[model samples]
Target: MTIAYWCVLASCLLPLLAVGYAKFLSSDSDPKNYDNNNPRDYLAKLKGDGQRALWAEKNTLEAMPLFFAAVIIAHNTGADQATLDALAISFIGFRLLYIYLYISDKATLRSLSWFAGLACCVAMFIISA
Candidate 1:
């Protein structure tokens, strides 16, 4: 309903999007290969952009819970909605940039973008109180 809520949705879905891209580009094109539960086996054939995409997707998933919890805590704790919305948008923006940087092999910029997204998550808590 709110921007923060939508951002949460976006955050939840972004990793899926990244992995979808990676899977589509993987050497194993048949969807049946995905039956394997081992991540190493599932992604063993990925290389270059595909490998980077997989890593980015995993990183985004790892970060998802923190952002989700942070945004919800901020909203429930009566943090300013406008500020929460801004931070939510910033988190998404930075994450998108982080994915792009990673896929493009820009390690330094990707790390900076990662920090910015994490900062946005931290700011949600800071602003809540």
Candidate 2:
């Protein structure tokens, strides 16, 4: 598969990292541990970085369909392979930065990264046209 295609796969899995942080790394290990049976309840109780991580996971998931469509449409419609790959990489990089900034509670930078990532998706669609 192309790098852009591989990036799609990577994008699919990226939420795991945030959810992992929210579920495992952020919580106390005792009675307040990750609740498999009531995961949402457990997650809802998180604050600060944990809550931000959960939000990051949710936001990433929400962004995926547009990204998936952009990459696939760009590929099928013959966007320049190298350019598509670069944009795909940029998207991933921006998303990674977004997640980190979110978890770190850097609101302004996180919004910038989010917008940058969205721009990459839009670029993919435009390149295909």
Best by lDDT: 2
- TM-score on alpha carbons, each prediction: 0.87, 0.94
Task: Give the residue spans of candidate 2 off by over 4 A.
Answer: 27-32
Report the Cα lDDT for residue 123, model 2: 96
Per-residue lDDT of model 1, residues 1-129, tens digit only: 899999999998888777877777554444666645775676767788878989999999999999999998998999999999999999999999998898889999999999999999999999988
C-alpha local distance difference test of each model: 0.88, 0.92
lDDT by residue (1-129, candidate 2, tens digit) is: 999999999999899999888888874423455678988888888888889999999999999999999999998999999999999999999999999999999999999999999999999999999
Q: Which regions of candidate 1 deviate over 4 angstroms?
A: 26-42
Number of the predicted model whose TM-score against the real structure is largest: 2
Question: Which lDDT value does model 1 have at 80?
Answer: 95
10 residues in a row with least lDDT, candidate 1: 26-35
